[model samples]
Target chain A: MTAPIRKLRVATTSLAGCFGCHMSFLDIDERILKLVELVEFDRSPITDIKQCGPCDLGLIEGGVCNAENVHVLREFRKQCKILVALGACAVNGGLPAQRNRLDLRDILEEVYVTEDGLARGSKIPNDPELPLLLDKVRPIHEVVRIDYFLPGCPPPADAIWKFLTDLIAGRTPVLGHGLLHYD
Target chain B: MKTSNSEVSAQANARGARAKAARPAEANNVFTIDGREIPFEPGQTVMQAALTAGVFVPHLCYHPEFRPHGSCKLCTMKVNGRPTTSCTLPAAPGMEVENNTTEINDKRRLLIQMLLVEGNHFCPSCEKSGNCKLQALGYALGVMSPHFTLFYPVRPVDASHPEMLLDFNRCILCELCIRASAEVDKKNVFALSGRGLKKHLIVNAESGRLADTDFAPTDKAAEVCPVGVILRKRRGFAVPIGKRTYDLKPINEQADRFKPLTPLPKEEF
Candidate 1:
């Protein structure tokens, strides 16, 4: 007789980011095998089906800057039992937050609709599918309740692994001394 | 009048006898640091005791004459399981102190880093480049950069003081100069303004630039500043970097050896 497997479902989503966090997660290297054995990937691009569904852990990378990002984050919060804000962008808005000090209209006009720009040569329609931009880039917690936060430019791969493994084993994770505390 | 004078004399004699009776001949306790235990006279500060014990605790505001105010929070230690400022706490018996914890060192490093950022600490260009306590602490902590953004508040120099210069840029606001001026010299020439992050030293009550204040160059405040903020105008860069404070030993090690005479209550996380 074999012991029944306690399947743990997990998902990963990105918002206003360069996907550096996902790269860092991949850097877990050999530990990824151990992780895959413990948790079933649900909506991550690296594994499983692409469409997001109900999951045990929701790992969110990046801040909420656009309308679609907010919608996706809200959906994740509704679906997942635990939500982890991954990396600096999700934790404190990171480098994108530097632009938060600027006006949103100025950003749009400069990038998309200026005289020397994308909309200059053709007519640009205001489509319903296009998400509107927010005034400032804010960390995930500011918009909704975040269960855990890993703060770093992209949190060291070891930290992410520890968090995941501890959860899978049903044990409380202790942040390692001073090295783990960024603040 | 005659009765009052005789009464005063009798009271003085009684007080002198009481003082003599109260004085203890032998010291009460000795504590070990690293591996060496040193005896201290009653009422001597931990820094003083350590210095007597040949243990060096690098400090800015701690002077033998004045009271110890642990504002810098650089001289932090882990006693048993908690972090504490050492200068103000009284020494106790059977205390299990650990000053070399990575946590304590990190906190001290952050403290110095914050200090470096809070002021315009351009060591290479400043006159007090070599002998400054803040610089020494930076070198001791192995500070790479200011780490935080510089406020760069446009502070003016107080050359009004004939013999000294009060450059607010170099000021760490340790309050040593303020205390030394008020208590030791009996002159309230220096004052601190603003609060929290904005807190800084003001020369006079008016918050006028230091040059405009009625500060004497020979004021004790000018003499006591641990950094080059309050410099003796002519003596800039007199000491070379090789002979400076950081070259001696790391500040964390120096502070660890000089256990607080009295241990403060542990800080909560």
Candidate 2:
């Protein structure tokens, strides 16, 4: 008999986001059992892996707002054969990029020094563990090539399901007017 | 030469022909837009006519109730082989109009980009996300993102209306509110006071708030925003995602439901 087929390796991550997209992905619910039969998790939050190892697909959530975000996105691009921007944050910088209009210096000062409700000893929280913020937040595609984009704030669970199923079946996921929405 | 009866009649006819030639071309109420015949009433612009005929011409500022401002330039169409704004261009019988062409749509995409960059349109966070006409048009046009560099202009939000909020950052300057306030509401509570990039909408009060004016929440201007600029307070996200207007049906299909009449006999434009 011929050798058994290998399961597709899938990875996911959230950078500079509230993990809402990841939550939406989990919203796929009971389908996760069916998904396990076709694919294996690699460096996803679900897998709790430190690094992605030759993944077939990667779903990226959030924009590149900090150095760590850029690093993680570039790594996903390098490791995964197909990369999909999972939500509005990864597609157009989303709400996080609103800070791009404001002065970064002023934002830092307002939170760290000038704000009245801050903890008494709170500073800018400078530490080696923290990643440096970029002057402007940018969509993940600007930093790396994205194979696909899902345009909802956090795309509905059905939309994500359709995209994943299409990709798994080796078909291009073409979002109709009903499927694609910015809001 | 002796004047005869036939000669006298011919002289009078010649004078009549000259006067007719001097006058403008007779009005033709029929027109063809994209190979489809559209019948328009007198005084209707091409945009209005197309809308009445169930043809969706992508536009921003050309509301039916308001006078055509022609500022958005999104409804630019080729009328009689000449580029013109359909919102302001009156429909003429026998006119050949091309509204859905690659060239015109490309220009419209550029105009949409300019509007996005010139303002801070963060649709994901805006309360008017689903029902916002600008966002729907952007989706319909397949504008993946604001192609140009993000201008991210800083503007203030006026929350002093008590019942309404004025977020100038989302304003596309469609002048719908200005016209509604003046023509429909009869309050003349709004005006545009700047030029070029500095151009912006202003309330008719020294305090720069809607509450100061006689403007009420029930005014036509309050409900006329095609974008997320003028929003009712305390009603944010009243409709959840997936159940929103554009979410259930796309803009094109939504427009198709607004057709005014049934099938009519084809007529020449």
Candidate 3:
């Protein structure tokens, strides 16, 4: 008889993403049953765990758009052996980086102060609790080292499944043909 | 007159010879792409010949109907130990072309990533997400990350025209529209201005807007764009995601062996 196999510990988080990646992750559907047998969740939305423990794989979605994102990403990087940037946002700043051309102050003022529908005395918010926004939205790799990147708007559930299965089987994850898409 | 059996057989053979002369002659010249020998005619570029043979060379600005621009350089391959644009290179005998190699494909991947970061290719929100050549190429080449700083240039979207929109931010500077306008449509409604990094597409009207020109939906320039530069008024996501052209299969697999060689003259209307 051979030795028992240990489940691979995986952690995941969303920064500036729409949580579509996570939804797609859950979109793995009944494969989640098969996935659970091979991997255990840590600091994931599925577990509702806030703090990340030492993990085998870290799946991070979204770009680093603010101070809190950098802090969280750096911390997550330290605990995982391999870190994967998930989806288009984390790959290249995706849709959120569209605002990189405009000044953050101008965007805030336009939305909060000068818009036609805004109230008379409205101004940009400045609370101690709010995380300060960065001048330019950046991909996660600009802040920390990312081992692998999964591309797609929200990588198709099948793409994510293929990525995970390839990694689990000691293979360099290669998303090919129908499995790879940037949108 | 009564005909002998030998005379009738000879007449049938002569009739078949005349019919063969009427059809366009098939390509007999041969060149190798990635060690796979394919046929090419004398006038055809390597890309045209490759596509005609159902092979893909990973091009952006190349459309079969239009003349080869060779600007994108995505089709660069080692033609007998020298890197040459397959779109502009002529087919010759015993030409050893190496495409799909690890060295060449890595360069293609880098070229794509450079294009991706050089422009603001916001694929998720862009109307040409699934259908865009740039997006399809990014996936085709395994560009995991852009690996470069974003330009995020503040380019104007010319919605002055009532029927169409021109988003300059996504322009890869592929001059397909410029060629289609001047050569095919004979309209001279579009031109490129400036040099190097500052080079950009501009309308050929006095107001520098598309509305001031005689441009219409029927023009070939309106439909020759490989990216999201030229778009119609309101039908952005008409074909739902996961069902678009490149979504179902990669661009390499979609090359048609029986596709007509004529440039599409009426796709605009």
User: For candidate 3 chain A, which ten residues in a row score worst on lDDT?
Assistant: A1-10
User: Residue A32 in candidate 2 has what lDDT?
Assistant: 81
CA lDDT, candidate 3, residue B32: 66
lDDT of 3 by residue, A129-183 (tens): 9999999999988888999999888899999998998888887787777767677
lDDT of each: 0.63, 0.78, 0.81
lDDT of 3 by residue, B85-200 (tens): 98887777656666766677778888998898888887777888778888777777777788777676789799999998999989998999999999889999989999988998
Over B34-129, each residue of candidate 2 has an lDDT whose tens digit, in order, gives 656678986667887898888888888866555677888988987766889987877777676777655676677788878877888877788888
lDDT score at residue A138, model 2, on the 0-100 scale: 84
Q: Is candidate 1 or candidate 3 better by lDDT?
A: 3
Tell how far residue B121 is off in model 3, in angstroms: 1.1
lDDT of 2 at A160: 87
DockQ, each predicted model:
0.02, 0.20, 0.32
Query: Chain B TM-score in candidate 3, rounded to 2 decimals?
Result: 0.84
Sorted on lDDT, best first, the list reads 3, 2, 1
Task: Candidate 2: list runs displaced more than 4 Å.
Answer: A1-9, A33-41, A53-56, A80-82, A113-120, A168-172, B1-29, B80-83, B100-110, B237-244, B256-269
Q: Rank the models by TM-score, top first.
A: 3, 2, 1
Worst 10 residues of 2 chain B by lDDT: B1-10
Alpha-carbon error at B117 in model 1, in Å? 16
Number of the predicted model whose TM-score against the real structure is largest = 3
- Return whichever of 2 and 3 wins on lDDT: 3
After superposition, the stretches of candidate 1 with alpha carbons farther than 4 Å from their true spots are A1-4, A47-51, A113-126, A175-183, B1-27, B30-87, B90-269
| CA RMSD (A), model 1 | 15.0
lDDT: worst 10-residue window of model 3 chain B: B1-10
